[model samples]
Structure formats: C-alpha cells, structure tokens
Target chain A: MRTLILLTTLLIGACSAGPQPIRYGEDACNYCKMTIVDQQHSAEAVTLKGKVYKFDAIECLVHYVSPLDETTFSHLLVANYDNPGVLIDAKTSSYLISPNLPSPMGAFLNAFDDANRSSAVQREMSGELHNWQSLKRTITTRNQIPN
Target chain B: MSRGLSLILFFFLVSISTSVGNKLHVGQDKPYATIHSALAAATAGDQIIVHSGVYRECPVHINKSITLTGYGMPVLDAEGEKEGFIIEADSVTLEGFEIRNTGFSYIEDRAGIRVKRKHISSFRTTDYITLFFGIYLEHAKSGIVRNNALHGKPLGEANSGNSIHLWYCADIDIEGNLIRGHRDGIYFEFATECRIRQNISEGNLRYGLHFMFSNDDIYTGNTFRDNGAGVAVMFSRRIHMLNNLFHLNWGQAAYGLLLKEIYDAEIRENIFQKNTIGIFTEGSNRINYVDNDFLNNGWAVKVAGGCEKNKFHWK
Candidate 1:
C-alpha cells in the first residue's frame, strides 16, 4: 500500500509538470494586479516545478521576471500579437516598440511570432524592433528609477 | 432724490447681471453648429447648453472655465472611435450628458470625458489602476462631474478602462453617475480629498471601485455589483469607506473588498453580500472595520499573512 501511494504521487507530479493554460478574465496578473483578460497581450512563465505566473501584458511578464532568478523559470512565453491568446516561446519571440501600438501599461510594446512579423509593423509604424534579450534590457533600463 | 433712486436701481441690476452667467445654446440652426465653435466663442463663467441631439463630436477639448450643461441629456457619441471631451480648465462643471462609444486602444487610454493638467511624473508609479478610462481626471482641482451616464462595451478578459478615473486630482466631486461596462467602475490614483457619492457602478470587468496611493479620500453610498472584484484599496491610507453596498461579485479573484498594504483607514457600515470573499487583507495595518454586515459570503474575511493592529466589530 505504501509503494502504491508513492507511485501515485510521482505520477500526479509528473503529469502536472507542464505549462497550464492561463485562466483569462478570471486570473489576476501576479505582478501588476490587472486581470489577465487581453489574450492578445497576455504572458506567462512557468517554473521548473510547474508553478505558473501569468501577467496581463508582455512587459508585465518581463517586469515580473526581471527581479527574479532566471534559473527557476523553465518556460517563458508571450501571447502572439497576430494570433491573439496563443502563447509563443519568449526566448525567440520578436518585439516591436512603437508609439502607435500602446500596450496596456502604456509601454508601447508588442510581441510577435517572429522577426519578420515584428518588422512588418515596424515598417509602417516606424518603431524599433527587438528580440527577447534586447527587449528585456531596454525595458529594465528604461524602468529603472533614476537617482 | 430722483437721481439717487436711479443710481440705487442701477447698482441692484449690476449685481444681478454679475451673478448670472451668459448662456450659449447649441443645436441645429443655432448660433453655433458644433460645440467646438461655441466653446471658442465662450468666455469664463459662461454656460453652454446642448440640446437633445446626437452630436458625433469626439475630442471636445474644453480649455476654459465654463459650465457644459445638457438640457435634455444630449448624446455625445464618439462613434466607437475617439474620445468625447478633454476638459483642461479648472472649476469646470459638466452635467447631464450621456457619453457613448468610447473606443478601444492598446496604446492610448481613450475616454468619454478627460480632464487633465501637467502632473508630476512620480505620481504614475503609485497607480494601481490600468489604462483606457471612461471619465478620466488628472491633476485637476475643484471640478464637478455630476449626473452623467457613461455606457461602454468594455472587454472582459483584460482591462478596458475605468468608468470614472481620477489621477493626481484633489477636491473633485464625482457624484451621481451611472457607470457600466468598463474594466474598473471607478478608479483613483494619487487623488486626495475627493468625494465620491451615490454612484451605481455595475457590470464591470474588474473592480467596481479601486484606488491606490491616494490618501484622505471618501467613498459613500455607492453600489457595486457584478464585477470581477468589488473594490480594491491598495497602498493607501486615511480613507473613509462608508455606507457602500457590494454584492454578487463572484469569481476566484473577486472580493467584496480587497485591501493590500493599506493603513490607518476606517471602513464603516458597508454591506458585503453574496461575494466570493467579503474582505481579503494582506500586508495591511491599522484599520478599523466597524458596524459592517458580511452576509452569505464564501469567506467573510480572508486574512493573509503580515496584517497587524486590525479591529473588526459588527452588530
């Protein structure tokens, strides 16, 4: 009976060790306190142990993750701008910083599926294009309180 | 004696003329075809009366101290595209207008009526509410937004905007407004000494009323129902929340009132009924919860860790 219980616990834990769908409209952003409603701009991060933190916007995801240790997070994902609610891998996701596209937090940031997709909007809106690394750095530096 | 009598009558008439403001009428076949023309021709202490007509005039910028009154509850339609009015003047009176179709924008926080002045930038850091508001007031003082109905089709999943939003404003009276279908029914950030009374805020996506980083504010006799969260008071101190009704706000994150990091506040005589959580507190201190009725709630008061010096008393 003991071995059977241990086996069941392990099975349940393993099965739960994956990304969960963010409960939109119902779930509050763990960082900014807004409800995760805009599927087009929502973001989420999964820890290695399967704990998930959802955010209302992509910048909120970045703002939340910036102060934390990176090794704890296993998956970083953002909602695809074109697809709307479809979470894409954040490491390779393309970003657009444009005055025309105002994010929920007024950051003027949007995430796309690829570089080409971000570039397409940049062509007309005249914005700077960025990737995961550059966008994180830009947001971090820009939001840093000046002395 | 006749000259003296004429001079006394002339002085009396001058006092009456000074007390009453000039009234400018706006409607079809009137002196001004659009509200913009009337506003331009109007002076300080003048009243603009708009007749009952659908005016598709968004972005109505009011830069002078004047009374913009609607005679028969005129409709100022944004046509689901632009903002309705941006009032930048002090001591402005906006009354009896039905503002409609404040459109959506991820970039801009559009609204039905927006009053603002240049605000200190650090105030933005203390804000808990999100963008895109219905009636937005920023850095404004001594203004009155009363007896207005704002109808919006707000998005449910995320923040569409607050029905009435105040930022860095002081001594403003937001009263008797029916606000529906927005992210937050009413939101305040860095606002002080404001009086919010007798407002019906329902069908909102997020909190019916939310304020943060604001101090010495008062909210009374308001009804908040069918919201994601009834009211969220965060990072604020010295507030008076009295005689408010919060009901039927059902959700995982919903609460009749959610208090976080608040201090030195008095919540009195409020009825919290049929809510998922009557009151949830975290990191809050020095609060007096008195004479409040908590009825049929899932958790009457869910006290998280780090709360201190809290008193709860009820009949």
Candidate 2:
C-alpha cells in the first residue's frame, strides 16, 4: 500500500507543469504585437485558470499585470540572463537597472538568479540592483511619466 | 593609333589591372591561418580567400576595398559574442560565408554582416534574435546584397530584429535572398532609390517588408508569406511595387499590404491571397493599384480615414 502511494505521488509530481520555454520565433507577446526573441528580457505569467501569457519584455508584463487584480495571476516568471531560457520566480529574482544594459522595450532591466552576480553586474554596468518590489516601484514611477 | 581606339585600349588595360590584384589565402596550410591576419596583410583591390573551417571571431572589420571570398563556405561563428562582420570601405565584395550567432543587444545594432559601405553576397545567418539584424546597411550608397539566407528566432517585437535592415542608404540592390522568422524580413528606414527583387521573406513576426520614411524605392518579383503584421509602406513617395506575392499573412491587425501616408505610389501586378486584409490604406494619397489579384482574403481592401485621390482597378 505504501509503495502504491509513493508511485502515485511521483507520477503527480512529474505531471505538474511549471514554466514553459518561450518559443522565440513562434510565440507572440500577449500585450505587444511583437514576437518574443530576447531570452533574457522576457516574462511569463500564468493565470489561475492555467493559461500562460508571455511578454517580450519585463516592462510589458508589468504593465499588463499591474492593472489586474492580485488574485488573477497564479505565477509570474522572468528569464535569467546567466542561464538563457530558464525561468525563475519573478518576486524572488534580483533585477539590475542600468543604462548600459538595454532591455527590449528600452526599460534596461535584467534579471539575475544570484544576488552576488546582480551586484557584480551593477558594479560593472553602473546600475542599481533591486528586488521585485523595488523594481515594480521604479516601473510604476517611469510609467507615470507623460508621453 | 586613333583617339577612340587608344581610349578603348586604355580602359581595357585599367580593367585588367584592377581585376588582376594579388590573392591572399587563409587556411591551415597557408601562411595566414586567420581571416583577420589575411585582411591586415591585404590592400585595395586584393582578394582574400578563406578555407573551410570554423572561425570563432567577432567584429571582423573590413576597412579596405577588397574581395573576401570563402571556399567550401567557411563558418564565421560569433558564438553569441558581438557582430560577425563590419564593412566600411567602398567597392568591397564579401561572399560565401556561413556567419552565425550574433549576440543580442538592445543598445547596439549587431548583425551577421554590417555594411557601412560597399557590397556583400552569398552569406548565411542561422537563428538570431532581438535587435540582431542579419545584414545591416547604414549610410551606404550603391551596394548589392544577394543570394543570402537569414533565419531568426523571434519571440516578440521588442526582442526580434529585421533580417535585412537599411537606414539612410541609397541605390542599393537586394535580390535572391531567403529571410525568415524576423520582426521584418526587409526594413528600409530613410532609404531612397533602392531596388528589392526576387527575394523570399516568410514566417516573420512583423511585416515581411517594412518601409518607413523611404522614397523612390522599387520592389518587384518578391514573395512575402505568413508574416504577422504583414507588409507596411509608410511616409513614402514615388514607390513602385510590381509582380510581388503576398500570401497567408493572417492576423487581427494583419494585411497583405498596409500603406500609410504614402503619395504617388504604383502597386501593380501583385498577388495577395489568404490574408486577413489584402490592402489597408490610411492617410495615403494619389496611389494607383492596377492589375493586382486579390483572392481568399478576409477583406479585399480597407481604406481608412484621410485617404485621397486613390485609384484601384480589379483587372
């Protein structure tokens, strides 16, 4: 009976879907009409209903999710620059904003899995490193500027 | 000799001298094993031949007028570094190379081959993304790009770049190239008097061909298929499009051709099939569409607000 339970648990764990790879030439951004080609600058959000939405840039994803209610999305993910095509939890990842590191939508935000690497890049590229909360604040502040 | 005879003889002699420049070889057996070294040793009107091998280098700058040809299609792999080639001289010809893996950068415009001046041909780029143009021409006058293949892996508009991008260029000829999976297959920004012919651009994320603020350009005998936003010609005058095929470009905002703020253009003898909209026009004036075939499209032609003096003939 215990062996049967363990087998079932393993099957369930394997079946759970996590972050998916953004098909670069094939997948279009949900917000912008542009295709998602930048591996390091892309974002993905999974809704409560399990529908995944991909964004070309982190700014686009932020802009899209900012207007929604907190309960709408189940997960938000960002690509790690050190490892291309790998998604990490957006809330936990560290972001570096620099003029030298230009993002797809001119936001110049890059995500890193390691805080030390983020700080290293910050030293070289001359930018401020921020967590998700601080990065959101900066994005909101930038978006408030009138075009 | 007679004056005319002497002039003809002199011209022939000059052509012979120009064509008979010294040849430099770069191979395992040759004195120079790297293209960079061969290029450094070469002068104007010389020929540098690269043998078959994978060369890991970035930003191969060509500043002298010379012919750089490869035997057995030497691979110039950038390996996700910087750009592959940068040409800055006049009358330079580059041919037969497999240039690949230009790293993506938002601030810099990286490319498989960037021509600031002069000519290139018979090259290929495999799978680039995000502001990495396959072939780029900037401020160049009178060049030719032909018989090349450019493939991109575009996921979004902000990340993808144009396959063949031209800016502030004039009298350029682009022909016989296959471009796929880019933001735009061919993009002309402020480029004038260019001719695009016999190229196949398909499966791109944005328009197969995009022209912005360009004038007096002619595109003929090209195929554009399965693009996202389709083809767009905007803010241009005296443009001629003939004998082109636009097919299977279907999306909510897609059209076979979108003309905005264009003037005195002639679109004739083209085929538009299986597109969301065959032709979408806005703020365009004095344009002529004649003998173009439109079949199996969602809307044949949608003329939006502020369009004037346009004439369309079914047959």
Candidate 3:
C-alpha cells in the first residue's frame, strides 16, 4: 500500500512539469516592429538547461538566437492555427502559406506543429500539405505537376 | 599494276577519313563516353550525335566549338548532385535533350544550364558586366540553344533551381524550347544585346522569366503561364518585350509581371490575362507600356508607393 502511494506521487510530479505556457517577445517584432501578440504567431524554445524563451515571430527568433549555436535548442514550439490548443514540431511541420492566406505580413501561413493539425487546417482552408518529395515535384520547379 | 595500286590507295584513304570523323554514334548502346572526348575527336564542325540514354554525369565542360545533338530526348543526369552542363567555349549547339534531377542544397546554386558571359555587341567596351546564368557563356561570343526541354524538381526556397539560365552571353539565339519547374524558367542576369525568342515556360514556382540587373535585351514571341509568380524585371534598363503571352498566374498576390527598379524599357503588344494581379511595379522609372492587353486580372497594376518617372500609354 505504501509503494502504490509513492508511485502515484512520482506520476504527479512528472505531470506537473509538462510544458508551461510561457509568454515571450520584445515590445515589438525585431524585424517588422509591429506590437507582439503572444496568442498569434509567437515562438517558444526550450534550452538545454530546461529554460524556455519565447518570441513573437520566427524571424525575430532567428535574429535573437543568431551567433548562438542552434543545437542548444531542445524543444521548439509554434502555434497551430487550425487547432488552437496544440503545438507541434517546427522543422517537420507543413505550411499552407500563400499570398491569399491572410496574415499581418500580407497573406501567408506561419508555424504549424502537428501534421494531423496541418492536414485538418489545410482541408479547412482548401489547401494541400505537400511532403518534401512531392512538394519538390510541384513548386519551385521546371516540370509538369505530375498527374 | 600501277592502276590497281592507285585504286586500292584511293579506297583505303576514303575508309580512313570516314572512320576519323565518325568516332561516336548516336542511339548506340554504350556504357559512357565523355562529351568532351567525342567533341575533341570530332572535326571542326562535325556533329557529335549522343543517343537517347541517361548520361548519368555532368559538369559536362564544353571547351571546344562543336555540334552535339542527341537522338530523340536524351536524359543528361546531374543526379541533383552536381551543377548541370557547363559551357566554356564558343559556337556550340545543344538540342533535343532533357536535363533533370538536380541536387538540392542551401550553399550551391544548381542550374540546368549556365551561360557564363554577358551578351554585348562585338565592338562595345567591357565596362558593363552582368551576372552569369544557366546556359552560361563566360567570354563566349556566339552560341545557340534550340529545340530542347529542361525540367527540374526544386524543393523549398533553397532547393529550387533555375531552368534555362544565362549570363554574360551575347548574340545568342534560344528558340522553340519548353522549360518548366524551376525558380525562373528563363533567367537573364546580366546578358545584354541578346535575343530570346519562341519559348514556352509554365508551372514554375517563381518568375516565368526573371531578368535582374541586365540591359539592352530583346524578348519576343514567348509564352509564360501558370507560374507561382509570373515575371520579374529588377534593376534592369533598356529592355524590349513584345508579342508575349502572360496568363493564368493565379495566387493571392501573384502578378502577370513585376517591374521593380527598372528604367527606359518598352513593353508593347503583350497579353496579360487571368492573373491575380496584372502588373506590380515599384520604383520602376522612365518606362513605356504601349499597346499591351490586360484582361480579367484582379488588379491591372499596383504602384506600391515607391514609383517615379514612368509612363504607361494605352493604344
């Protein structure tokens, strides 16, 4: 009975340390100097020592972290526009950015974390989430979009 | 006896001369032979007929002047691993070939063909310089590329390669070619006094034809359609565009043609239709847009705040 109680206590500690919603940004984006809105197009980065720093845009995040080794970032999270609550990996995530997508920076899609979320949002927005291989075949190319 | 000896000598000489000129045969099943070797062994203007097979190699450096023709559509594989065909000599012709599968990287600027020289009149001083491009012509005076097809699958902004790229080339003729799936279908960076005619570019991610910092060039009778962004002319001067069709460049902010920081150009008798935006101009000065058609586009032209000293005449 005592061991069962101890195991339950450890599980609670692990659950408590799950990603805290930390807010970060300058007074404005370093690139465009627009007022930083934490809920929209913000950045989240976890360091090697378990510290998270936030920024308003990926551009700002890149500028801020320049000269610092990129390998220091452990976990990076950006907002998922489709399902508001979820955050996904930045490097692997697909983007549905176009001139028509509607953002402060003209019309373009920003950071997305989840593939399922990206797919859901792409379907909602009538767009397509192209994989790296297939995306190569479609855009930035000199051949026909294969049928 | 002397007559027979003379006849035998004559036949031997004829056979030897024929074998000397015909070193490489087109449409033959051979492992691989260097395009350079075939050109060197060939006579001054002999035709080096390359067959219809995937010649899985590149940096196919051309240093001598010759004619290299491929049977059907030969595939020249850069393997997406090295820069495609590089031309260093003069008076060479490449035709009836399909070049594809480019290697992607953030560091290297890979292209299907790189022309390394700026196109200028023979008597002109060398004060003005243009950036080199695909089908590159560096110090090369005269060349021609016709009836060839080029396709590249570029991924992301970094991986995307340019098709039919040219630079520092002069008096060149590019006719009846189909190019698609690249950063720019046909890019002329610093080429001057050149002519690009009768080509079709479609479904590219960036400009169908991108010319930046170039001068004194004539582009006519070409079709640019369904590109990610239609066309861009930046920091260039003295251009003449006529009898071209720009259509179906539909995206949120895509334009049929984008003129930025250009000067003293003539854009006449061209058609722009079914694009999200017809012409987007910024800081483009002292230009003439005469007798051009802009139909069914979202916005005919948008002068985004930074324009000065430009003229647009409708006839």
Task: Name the top TM-score candidate.
Answer: 1
Q: By descending lDDT, how would the candidates be arranged? A: 2, 1, 3
Global Cα RMSD, each model: 6.7, 8.9, 16.4
DockQ of 3: 0.02
lDDT of 1 by residue, B36-135 (tens): 9899999978999988888887789988878887877777888777887787766677766767677777556787777786531111100011125667
Better of 1 and 2 by DockQ: 1
Error of 3 at B251 (Å): 2.1
Task: Return the TM-score for candidate 1, rounded to 2 decimals.
Answer: 0.77
Could you say which candidate leads in lDDT?
A: 2
Docking class of 2: incorrect
What shift in Å separates residue B5 of candidate 3 from its native position after superposition?
31
| Per-residue accuracy of model 2 over B218-259 as CA lDDT, tens digit each | 999999999875678866788999999999989766779988
Off by over 4 Å in 1: A1-18, A31-34, A38-42, A57-68, A78-147, B1-20, B118-132, B155-159
B-chain TM-scores per prediction:
0.87, 0.91, 0.78
lDDT of 3 at A139: 38
- Pairs of residues clashing in candidate 1: A37-B157, A37-B158, A102-B106, A102-B107
Q: Which sections of candidate 2 miss by over 4 Å?
A: A1-147, B1-20, B118-131, B155-157
Which lDDT value does model 3 have at B261?
A: 66
